[model samples]
Each structure stands twice: as C-alpha cells, then as structure tokens.
Target: MRRYGPAVLLLLTGAAVLRISLFGDLYLRYVQAGLRPYLIVSGCALVLLAVVSAIISRRPYDDGCQGHRHGPGVAWLLTLPALALLFFPPPALGSYSAEREAAARAAQGVGTFPALPKAKVLDLTLAEFGSRAIYDSGRSLKGRTVRLTGFVTRDDDGTWYVTRLLISCCAADASTSKVEIRGVEAPPTDTWVAVTGTWHPEGRLGTDEAWPAVLDAGDVRTVPEPANPYEKR
Candidate 1:
C-alpha cells in the first residue's frame, strides 16, 4: 500500500490537470473559492506522504533505512480527504448560477442590443449575449433562430442551463450568461455544446420572456472547448 501511494498521487495529479483543461475555470466559477486552498493543502500532504514512503522503502538508497516499512494505515490518513471529495463533492452549479443569471438580466439596457442577422451564428460572449438579451428582451430574439455554444451549468431548479463564462482580463473578473434551453437537449456537463433556436421570451422581469428565451431550437450538439474559452462578452 505504501509503495502505491506515489502512483496514486501521480494519477490524481493527472486527473486534476485533465479536469482543469476540460472545464477551463469551471471549477473556480462553480466550486467554492475555498476549494483551491484545500486542493493545494491536499497536494502538499500527498507529496509529504510520498517522501516519507520513499524514505521507508529505501530500495534505491538502502544506506540508513535497512529494514523499515511503513504501516498501510499511514496511507489512509493521507487519503481520507481525497476519498471524501470523490464520494461527496461540494454543492455546486445551483442557486448561485441562477442568481448571477438574474443579475445579468437586470444590467442589460436598450442600447446594448443590435439587430441580429438571420440564419447566422451569434459569436458573442455569455455576458454580451446576456446583456443584449436583457436590453432587447423579447424583441430581438423573437422568430430569429440563432446558435450559441458553451458549457452546461445547472441552476437551483435542477433544470440544466447552457452557460458560458465571459472574461475581460482573466478568470478573476469573469462573468457568466445562461439560457434555459428546452426541446432538443440532454445532459452535457463540463462539455461544449452548440444550441440553435428561435428566441421566445419567457416573460421574466426586465425581459418579456420566460426563463428560456430560445425556442424551436435545432442542431443542439456537443463540441470541444475552444482554446480561448473566454470571450469579451
């Protein structure tokens, strides 16, 4: 068990890297900020455990450690928090996202929106789209089908929302925009997906529409996260 600790740490490090690449700053956006500190602490603990384990094994340098073997239980102490995280992750992708989405709607004004072209893709950041949608509300999106892509973020209602985080400087100043998409949809967490639909106001505050503004959507397909995930929206 001690011998495998280093291998396990390496595997976890690889997994963390993969998750960061796939989700971009998703972990920071959705998960609590405190988690970053926890991750750092856990990493240090794992590294320390590996060093101690290596010293015990002493296979490569058997000078001082003639016959020292660490107990298997030592590994468990280092693994407790990590296992807990795997078994029960923090509550993320909930009310916080909805609150931010609503806040975005409030900030949008009449001047920000532009007349969208037909049969075309709207290449705007989540924040830009959100601002425009709020500003124009029902008028701009009605009867016009547009396509947008981003990561899936969940709201408090358990209804999956299509969202993208827009950044001006970096992840620290990032903002998000969301749309409640229905019809052609499935779960696509932490994955890039393209949705096509005509805007239909859901009749919420600020906008004369319901939660979902896009309707009769077509070609909702999953794709990869772009290299520059953040856009000036």
Candidate 2:
C-alpha cells in the first residue's frame, strides 16, 4: 500500500477536482467560468498521471527504488482536504469575506459614464452601481430608481451594506464592492436580497469619501443566492 500511496493520493485529489470542474458549475465558486476548460484539463492530466505512476510502480523492479528513500508516508494526510471537495465543496464567498477584506477598490478615475436607459427603474450589478455612485462625474445615478442584489454584511455600529465580491480571475483575488442600504431593516449576515432604491449620495465624486456608496432603499426583499455568486472585475 505504501508503494501505491502517492498514486492513490493523486488519483483521489484529481477525482475531486474533476467532480467539481468537469461535471458542474461548482468550480465557479473558486474560479471564473472562463477558466473551467483549464481546470477540466488539469483534472484529467492529474488523473492520467496518477494512473501512469501506479502502473509504473507495479512493474517488476529488480532495483525497487534501491537508492532513493521514500518521503514520509504521512504525506497522504494532505489529501484529506482535497478529497473533501468531492463530497462537500465549501460555500461561495459571502458577508464575512466581504467584511474581512478592504472593500474600497480604487476607481480608475472620475469620468462621465454612459447615459442610463430611459426606464423608470434599472437593474444593475453592485460593481456598476458602486462605480457610478462613487466615480461618475455626471451623477448618473441621481434621481434614478435602481434595483441591486447582493449578500448582506454589517458594521459594528449597526450600519449594513449590500455587498458583493468582484474577481479578476478567482475568489483568491476578489475585491469588494458595497453599497450602504438606507431605510431598510438589517437582515441576517449573508442573506441575499434585492434592494430597490435611489442613490443616496455622500462625498464628492472620485474621492475616497465617496467609497462604499449609499442607497436610499425603497423596497427590500430576500432572494435566492445566485449560482454564480460573484461579479467579474
């Protein structure tokens, strides 16, 4: 068994990766959708390598690793976490992740944004709303009723935010975008909600003070968490 330990570990880890990436959207919890092909390929490669290693290890060997000492067999224990992905993948990033990270991503610069559609209400992503609310020179969000959805996060002083994470590639590199929701009762942390409101402006445009934009919520309701819960940066 010791001789095959490394191969078994590799195979199990590879199976777990395939279980998440090859068969379903679960990989989205950890990485962007565009990277799915790479993940699937990697999982297949790992499984193939494990099979090859096992086959080679079982071959008749006169020397049987004659000179090289095997590393500690305890290395198999590292597979525990990897294998867990097969049965119970971790939840997507939520309120705690939003609060723990510095939520203020620097704006590229203050600029005039494109005009809003001539509609009574607009559906917007948290990042889009946050950027316009903070950095748009035209005050595009002013007087416009918009609906936004995100998970809930709160501050100690009872302030709460509708928070979402934006990732350039994956969860590890995610940055936060939050809007403080006004005129609504606080919900449990991590609960997903759709908040419809007008922009509640605070600081001057394109300034640090404008960070964590505010919303004057008109209506708030609980919603199902999205399957792909993250926004792309």
Candidate 3:
C-alpha cells in the first residue's frame, strides 16, 4: 500500500486541478449555500495528510522494509476521496431544484426575447436559453445552436427540461439552470444527457411576443457528466 502512495497522490492532484480549471467560473457565479467551507475543510485535510506522509516516509522503518514506502502509501490513501469525486459524482441540479431556487429564467423581467438573426449561428448554454425564455418570450434564443447538459426531469406530461446546477465548490452553493427541451426522445428522469438543438418559443403576445419558442433537435445522446457539470459559459 505504501508503494502505491505516490500514484494515489498524483491521481488526486489531477482531479483537484481538473475541478478547479473546469468549474472555476461556474463556482464563482453561484457560490452560496455554505459550500465553500466544505471545500476548505476537505482541502486542508488532504494537504495535511500529504505532508504527514512525506514526513513519515523520511523516517527509517525500524521493521526494515528495505525502502521508503509508508510515505507514498499515505499519500495514495489521501487521494482516494478526490479520485472518487471524479467518478461517482453528485447529480447536477434538476427539476427537484427548479422550485427551490428562484427560477433562473423567471428572474429576468417579463419581456420578449430577441429574434436570432437569420443565417447566423449563435451558440448558447442551457442557462442562457432558459433565462432568456423567462425574461422574454424566447426571442433571444430563436434559431441558434444551444448546447446544454443536465439530468432529464420529465413530468408525466410530455414537458421536459434539460438541467444542470452550478456549484461553488460543493452542493450547498448549487444553483439550478435549465432549458425547455420539447419535441424529442425524452430520456428517463435524472439521467445525464446532452442536447444539441435549436430553440423555439411559443405564443404570439406579451413577453412571449418578443421571443417565440422553437424546437429543432440536431442530435441527442446520453453522455457522461463532466467532472464539473455546471456551465461556466
């Protein structure tokens, strides 16, 4: 076990770096709910464990193991949690969260969305589309490539949403973001999936008048959730 310590540390370090790099922006956007403190605690524990292992490895083993393995072993064990983080990860924000947090879309004052320019390709994130729909009818999102990641939250009715949560460092800071995914193969609720489709707005008046909802799916697939599931973009 000691011999494998360095390998373990290496893996954990990689995971921590990955989380920081990929989710940093998303974390900043929604750093509420006391999530940051948990990160501080966990990070300190890992640093302390790594340091202690280094110290122990330097001390000669009275048992005469022939090499310094204890230090590395401790380092490896310290990494287990972080590696698990990269795998069996937390589910992103879904329908369960939609009602809990103020709707990301609703927050935008009632107005119509901007019509997407014809023949122009605009790329948007799930939050962008959802928020736009809430603020205006759906004008901002008309006719654009929207890329979103989330667990499927479906009602017995045909309506479904593609959603993900933005976490500051942990679950507490999680903020729900989602888009209406109409007209397509609906996966099971809570299943992680990716959708590449065009936005559609329904209704012809009021805030709905400005932006109209439209739906066009180019591709849909069940994909593994990224280590950092939130959309920084």
Candidate 4:
C-alpha cells in the first residue's frame, strides 16, 4: 500500500482538478476563462501519469526492491487539497474579499476616455464607471442615467457601496471597484443587486485613493449573482 502512495495521490489530485473544471463553478473562483483549457489538459496529464505509475509499481522488480520501495511521506499532503476540492469547494470572492483589499481606481493621466454610448439608459460596468468618473475629463457621465450591478457593502459610517471585484487573471490578483450609493437603503452585505442611478460627480478624480465614486441611485433591487462573478480587466 505504501509503495503505491504516489500513484494514489496523483490519481486523487487529478480527479479533483477534472471534477472542478468540468462539472462545477470552482474554476471560476480561482482562474480566468482562458485558463480552462490548460487546467483540463493538466488534469488529464496527471491522471495519465498516475496510471503509468500504478502499472510500474505492480510490475516485478529485481534486487528485492519491489515491495520495499516507499514514496516520500510529504506526498501524502497532496491528498488534503484533493479531498477539500471534492467535498468543500470554495465559493467566489465576496464582501470579505472586497473589504480586505483597497478599492481600485483609475490611474492618473490615463488619457481621454471615448464618448459615452448614445442611449436613454446606458449600462456600465463598475470598472468602466470608476474609470470615467475619475479619469475622464470630458465628464461623460454627467446627466446620464446608467445601470450597474454588484454586491452591497456598508462602511462604519453607515455609508453604502455597490462593489465588484475586478480580476486581471484570478481571484488572487483581484481588486475591487465600487460606487457609493445614495438615496436607497443598503441591502444586506454580499447581496447582489442592480442599481440604476446618475453619477453625482462629487468624488475626487485621478488618484488611487479608496474613495468610491458617488452615484445617486434612483432604484435598487436585489438580483442573483451572475454566472461569472468577477469582472475581467
């Protein structure tokens, strides 16, 4: 049994990876969409290696080494993650994660933002709204009714923000962007919602401060978390 430990560890780890990538939302929590192919390939390769190792372990060996060989004890640690992935896969990042990191802001002198879309009500992402509100000198958001969606967060001062995580690669590298919501009661923390409002233009611009751009919310309603929770940069 000890001689086959490495093979067992590989098999379990590979299956866990494949199970998460193929059958669940686990991949989205840790990686970007473009990485799915590589994950799948890696899972398959690990499983294949496990099979080869198992076969080799079962074969006859010379010098009385067949049953005496033992895998390094450290290899058993790999099973812990495999078991966790199978039984307790983690949820997507939420208000706790948002609270841990400082809010992201548009960089100074990011250059001119393009014109806002011509529409009665424009739908904008949290990151895009932050960029325009902070860095766009054109004030494209003035007098525009726009829609934004994100989870709710409340500050110690009783202020509320509609917050979303922006991920360039994965959750490990995720940063948050938010709009300070006014004129509506804040929903429970981490509750997803869509807010329709106009930009208030009172917040500072062109800095990386944690201050959220202000929005005067006309309407607020709870909604299901989207299939893809993190907004990609």
Top model number, TM-score: 2
Can you give the TM-score per candidate against the true fold? 0.50, 0.92, 0.51, 0.88
Please provide, for model 1 over 54-116, each residue's C-alpha lDDT reduced to its tens digit, 9 standing for 90 to 100: 565555635454333354546646655545444443433333443464432343345535666
Per-residue lDDT of 1-233 in model 4, one digit per residue for the tens? Answer: 77778788888888888887877667887888888888899889989999999999888667778436654677677788888876787888998888887555446674578888799989899989988888778888989999999999888998989998889988899988888999999999999999999998764567665257889999999999887788997
Worst 10 residues of 1 by lDDT: 89-98
Ranking by TM-score: 2, 4, 3, 1
lDDT of each: 0.55, 0.87, 0.58, 0.84
Q: TM-score for model 2?
A: 0.92
User: Which parts of model 1 are misplaced by more than 4 Å?
Assistant: 1-105, 118-124, 204-216
lDDT of 2 by residue, 16-105 (tens): 889989888899999999999989888998899999989987875466574333557677787788778888899998877887876455
Better of 1 and 2 by TM-score: 2
Clashes of each: 8, 0, 17, 0
Error of 4 at 29 (Å): 1.3
Tens digits of per-residue lDDT for model 3 on 22-133?
5453333234434545555565566566666666666666766755544443444566666666554444455687547653132336666556546444556665665565
TM-score, predicted candidate 4 vs. hidden true structure = 0.88
Arrange candidates, best lDDT first.
2, 4, 3, 1
- C-alpha lDDT of residue 83 in model 1: 51
Model 3: lDDT equals 0.58
Which residue pairs of candidate 1 clash? Answer: 128-233, 201-209, 201-210, 202-209, 202-210, 203-209, 203-210, 204-209
lDDT of 2: 0.87
